[model samples]
Target: MTTARRIPVAIVGGFLGSGKTSLLRRVLTGAADTAVIVNEFGEVGLDHQLLRACEERVELLGGGCACCTRRADLVRTLRDLLDDRDRGRAELRRVVIETSGLADPAPIAFTITSDPMVRHHFEVERLIVTVDACNGPAQLAAHPEVAKQALLADELVITKVDLVEPEARDRLAAQLSELNPAATIRTAVHGVLEHEALRASAGRAEPGARPDGRAPPPPARAGAGGHTDDVRTLCMDLDRPIDWLGFAVWLSMLLHARGEEVLRVKGLLELEDGTLVSVNGVQHVMHTPEHLPRAAIADPRPGIVFITRGLDVHRLRDSLETFQRLARAGAGVSGR
Candidate 1:
């Protein structure tokens, strides 16, 4: 008989004071079955203690950041969870790792995909980052780490909007848009975000995307962008499907030419052959692309989204458009 497969893992990351803890608390309380791994139990101990009565599977690594110092512990903990699932002792179906504010998500993601023992049992479902609406712009300007966190996210959540004025909220949202254009950002009140929307923003497969109740599509507007320090981000949309080989060549060239200046790039793209592909990049290094089974009636088109620091958007856009056009024209025509 075959053993039951372990579920996917979700990494929740953000800058300091970015409401990651609040969001975790809400998810822990609401989720039916889950296991959480945090740096220290005491860090968010109050909330953890409050939810202890939920009878959920919980594990805490008390010493260091899960991505760096405590990485071994993380591997061990996840292995144990898999063991339990195989033994029918625990009904653990998902895992969430709330990373430290200073953590870099790329290394953590790399570890998840590359670790032999953990890789077989679990896959990375999504990278979610929360931005504090009040301090987001200033943090982005003053800190490079803040930009890095936002760059790695599949979805960006703009938290604490009610703390500021209406106009300030709009400006904050705008800034988030400019810094990480590829991410899907939305406002939340306390921890009562539309779980389905947040999950959908991350992607269709990750936890929190499907709540028990019905949900509406998020407002059809581009996310807001904030200006911090000298760094900036630009977000754009492309309605056409991309040529797979051309896209590969174009991405490689772009990374070689301007990778150092790029912070992150994430998007859900449609290949010319009618398949959906999820792509993400941090600086010049990109993780392997994850392809989804094609939906019979869904449109296949490229949705270009980018997050760059100290790069020119107009020039970049022009270059991308030109390459896209050229790539389309040359595809399947043989070598030049």
Candidate 2:
């Protein structure tokens, strides 16, 4: 039997006054088939009221942040949206969840993926995070949540660029890149970015895929830019095809042991079957791995990037290599 199509979900997250609602307002204008779930930390949800003018299907989760106290409400709201779509009461092609300013996006992702019913009906398409150009530097230095939000994003939108000087904006962009080397960075003035750029499907590309067909140079070593909280980005290149079973075991163990410290991981891996798989995870929760068509990728070298806190890159690399070697040796003996 064929599987049913799942609704794609886009998560919009950032710190207070980071222009998330403004960005969402622009993206949702004239979007008839999209439903929105807006979370606010107070008893009254003012953001949802502003958003209702742009889209018809808007649900509010008031009185708590979506990442923690209001998580169950989020799940209920999503299931309710699905019910509306199923009953023909709503025509929904996509769902957007606007997390509260102080929300942690990882738990919201985990809630969707971990719920058996919800996971079957919905898939997280992308994580879009906004950063204030004026206050982003201080926020990154002082608030661990803001750094986590930036690091976990698939696309980082630097908002209010006009408020800062050109040099300051450039510096903020560079810092975001250092925090998340794999994410695509864009700038917005007055929360306005090209509509196409804000689309859920626009930013993701195969790791190291370039216009010239040459892999881009590897990211700089961690700590080179002196990031705060010991949070650093690490990039690793795969020299050979990886054994899938071994790779799975290695990742499972790593996340199980040090999940909190490993904030995010993104990679494209070449497996022993000569197929390429894309891996993405936030904290301990991983999105389902995706298989890529061989014809589409230009650079065949497999690469992985990690945004981690207080973790040694060398030790992590060694652990992965050791597991792969052991798996290969076991396969050889079994073959004989």
lDDT of each: 0.63, 0.73
> How many residue pairs clash in model 2?
0
Top model number, lDDT: 2
Q: Name the top TM-score candidate.
A: 2
lDDT string, candidate 1, 261-299, tens digits: 666666666677766777766655575686766552244
Models 1 onward score TM values of 0.70, 0.84
Model 1 misplaced regions, further than 4 Å: 1-6, 30-32, 46-70, 194-241, 249-261, 283-288, 292-301, 310-336
Per-candidate clashes, comma-separated: 15, 0
Error of 2 at 322 (Å): 0.6
